[model samples]
Target: MRRIITTIDIGTTAISTIVAERQKDGGIRILGVAQGPTFGMRRGSVVDIDEVTVSLKKTIQEASKASGMNIKKAVVGVGGTHINTYNTKGVVAISRADGEIAEEDVRRVIQAAENSIPKNPNREIIHIIPREYKIDNESGIKDPVGMTGIRLEVDAMIVDGSKSALRSIIKCVEGAGVEIDDFIFSSLASAEAVLSRRQKELGVMLLDIGGGTSNYSVWEEGRLVQAGVFPVGGTHITHDIAVGLQVHIDTAEKIKLEYGHAIPELFSKKDVIKLADFGLNGDDVYLKRHIAEIVEARFKDIFELASKELKRIDRFGLLPAGVVLIGGASHIPGIEEIAKKELRLPIEVGKKVNLPQPTDKNLQELLFTYPVALGLVAWQVNQLSGDNRYFYNPTFESVSSKIKNWFKVFIP
Candidate 1:
């Protein structure tokens, strides 16, 4: 029997599920995928338990029908402005009698790091990533296992979220009769889909623009360096267009997708969009420039915030791989150009690469918007089987293993 893995991406605008089989060749064969309008989630946090539960059931059922398999567990993606990271350090005395480091000693040191998390009744640690290790006062050690040292120290990054918000998501998933195998940050999952090894090594920023929010992750030297979420997203642009054009939300969204351009200069004055059918019975016909102006304004603001974040991290000058844009909002016309201009960095639209060429029109349409969901599936399989042939590792895997072993004792 083929081992199956499922991943759910609960976003501000939609909830998606993907079930795939782990093939012997280390590639994932997508068995089924399902999506529904999201509820109970805003800017990546669960807000309504009942609504989230109902949405999860709908998507899971759809995926089950297509895959012909029952999914009992899943890897879920989480994001929101409520999510934050802190830098922490920990030290421990080595217990090895001969003063030689062993696996158990390494495990203990990592546990010490995790145990040092400050107690916050409102927040819970979601992930702990060790940035570096020190052996016996000697710093810059990446892997301390098997190294002789009397003391062990570690620098780590702790990702935490509002406990109530996280519990709500977990309760909804469990209420749907499935366990969560793991939870990854939303931007980290998106980074798995679009970033190449070279980009991570040279430093890269990934921005996933969903319906209600935009999520970001920065990678450098083959490790996740930072992650954050912005409360604004593609939905804001639609709202702007709606208000600017004096049209309904649905009509505004349709116009934004069909005629929206982030750069006005790229569009010609001769270009026109028909608004008569849209019930805009006005003497002034809708011009492409108007739509571009509305989209550009919102998009510029989003990119400006992203730039400010980079500046705060002192990473503004270091992203040689520039910015990679993905998710539902990335489909807007001229987005790549707008991002390049506003962020002053090289920009590219993230496209799904590892799929069979669609032989039908319907499949092609589905492929375009579901890259994040598909990428989530890819990440799930990779984590379960330990195969990441596509990317390079800048950090020692031993560190991840040590952290995972320690976490299992508490989180499971």
Candidate 2:
């Protein structure tokens, strides 16, 4: 029996792994968590399989040892610039003679929704999540099972990616001695970790800022309205800092973590950083405000891009619950203030909490880094037990087998 859930997020900047157990209660107990730098991936897609395999093996071994659990199979989180999403609707005549909708009817409508999208040889369906459903004159039904309806209709968000890219990720994970159990969109997994039902219902945006690209999702009325990835991320910021300061990438990353701020005015002109302080040269110094300016410009562009994406979906700055920032880039100081100024909405950092008793010190500190992993754990727990209460929306079926069922729907 599989009682524990293991998750690995293949990110652009880092590979995050976590081993957690679902308690008798609804909460999760973090047994072990670990992260490793991405040696072979860029923008969340595999580039060098060998390097990624070695790095993933090390991270998995570390987490397994910490938890004293033998890790065999793992749920994988996927995100990249290759990811693309669009919305389409499908309708089907209810098959039951009594006109009472059943689970099979719901499934058929979802499959119809997917079939409406033409197949692309170069791309594959990564996720086909049902967003809304309609029955004849009735609309907005979430779960239509047991409901009376004549014509069943569904609107779904289709997420697809480069087929070659996905195959490479599967190969790398398997090469590391762990079998891939399932695949979930990394941003959606992060939503499971940080978003509450009320937040989704009241309208909220989730921004998962990673290393090479940032993944964002908009939720309103308890359904996903939009999902997109920005090509710029923390790595771009570090690159800008390195170029502006004429320093090494490592040095720029260190400075960004130490003194990075989205609001340059928050720092005084007199507050200076000496090169020697960070194991660099002697006596040379740079004004903190100047460094802040470099960091601020890059993030401003990210938020501005986010504003445009929101406007495309007509949810621009209108989410009542506002935007929740997660992932590695969210650690930057004063980032929320910059987001607020650029987007004209309330900005907040996603909460890292609600873990079971005996919380590991590492989990408490690095929970921010493992949002997607935590979400994978939550998702698996719900899948095994059919616990739809975890998330208000009912889209878990598509997390793994939804695509397979798409073709099965055509069979007589």
Candidate 3:
């Protein structure tokens, strides 16, 4: 029997679902992918349950039809302004008479580190990434299994999200008749699909700019160190375009795609683009430089916010691999140039090279936009049988459920 796996990403602008089959050779093949306009979601969080549920049902149903699979369970992607991350450390003593550290000892140390964080009723831990381990004061141990040490220590990064926001996501998915196998942060998932081993080890930052929110993840020394979400994204840019050009949002989005560039100086004032089709004057001509100016402003703001997060962790100039950009907004022209200028760092756009290309060429390009969905499948496969290279702690144990069924809402 073919092992069927599905991943669902409910974003502010769209609901994307990817259904894949695990091949006999331990590879994944794309079976179906559905990308539909999202409704009732704002800044990556569900706002209207009924509307979001309807969109989710439609997206999953389309994928189900294409793949001919029921897709009862899925690994979901969640991110928004409510997401947060911080560094934490956990320590524990080996519970064996021989002082040998076993797998359980490693889990205990990670659990201890997770427990170090203050409990917040409103927040729920989403990811616990072990940075490094120390055994018997010998520091910098990456793996502690099968080692002899009386004392074990682990430094990890804890990713958390709003409890209310998480519950809302769960409700939407369950309403769609899909069980949630696990929930991964959108930026982390994107990093899995785009970031390289060298980038993670040498230090790199990833930004996944969706329609309503921009999510970021920083990896250094082969570990995720920081992650966050900004309330601003492509949708905000479209709104700005609409307000500035006196056009409808749909038209502004089209113009932004067709004419917008992040670095205004690269374009000429004399070079004008006609927007007569968008209800502009009969001789409607807009200075390309002016459109670029608006694009540059918001993009600068995004980089500035990202800079603040890097500054907080003292990683502004510390990352040698620099910044990697992904998501829908990253497609905007001249964004890399503007990011390089504004952030004063090397910049490159992230691509979905890690995944196997779909048989349909058009669907292969969809991987770039729907990377989180792909990463969700990758993470699940890895968790089930593949070596646990990424963060694999199943659920946060310290924070008690604020609402009944909150933690178990998606479980079958």
Question: Which of the numbered candidates is closest to the native, going by highest lDDT?
Answer: 3
TM for candidate 2 is 0.92
Residue pairs with colliding backbones in model 1 are: none
Question: What lDDT is reached at residue 105 by model 1?
Answer: 71
lDDT of 3 by residue, 1-412 (tens): 7788899988899989999876666567788999899999988888899999999999999999998888898888988888887888988989999998898888888889877888886777887888889998798777888989789999888888888888888788889998777778888888766777789999999988889999888888887778889889999999998898777899889988888888788877688877776665677677888889999999999999999989988998788899998888898999998898777778998764554323334434766678788777767666656555557452433222333365666446
Query: lDDT of all the models against the reference?
Result: 0.76, 0.81, 0.82
- Kindly indicate the candidate among 1 and 3 with the higher TM-score: 3
Writing each residue's lDDT as its tens digit, candidate 1 over 122-195 gives 66666666667898769866667788878888777777777667777887988888887766667767776667
Compute the lDDT of residue 321 as modeled in candidate 1: 90
Q: What TM-scores do the predictions have? A: 0.85, 0.92, 0.92
Off by over 4 Å in 3: 279-283, 355-364, 394-412
Please report, as a residue range, the 10-residue window in candidate 1 with the lowest summed lDDT: 390-399
* Candidate 1, residue 157: how far the Cα is off, in Å: 1.2
Worst 10 residues of 2 by lDDT: 389-398
Ranking by TM-score, best first? 3, 2, 1
TM-score result, candidate 3: 0.92
Candidate 2 per-residue lDDT, tens place, 289-386, comes to 99989989999989989999988888887999999998777878999998999888999998654333324445556557788887788677777667
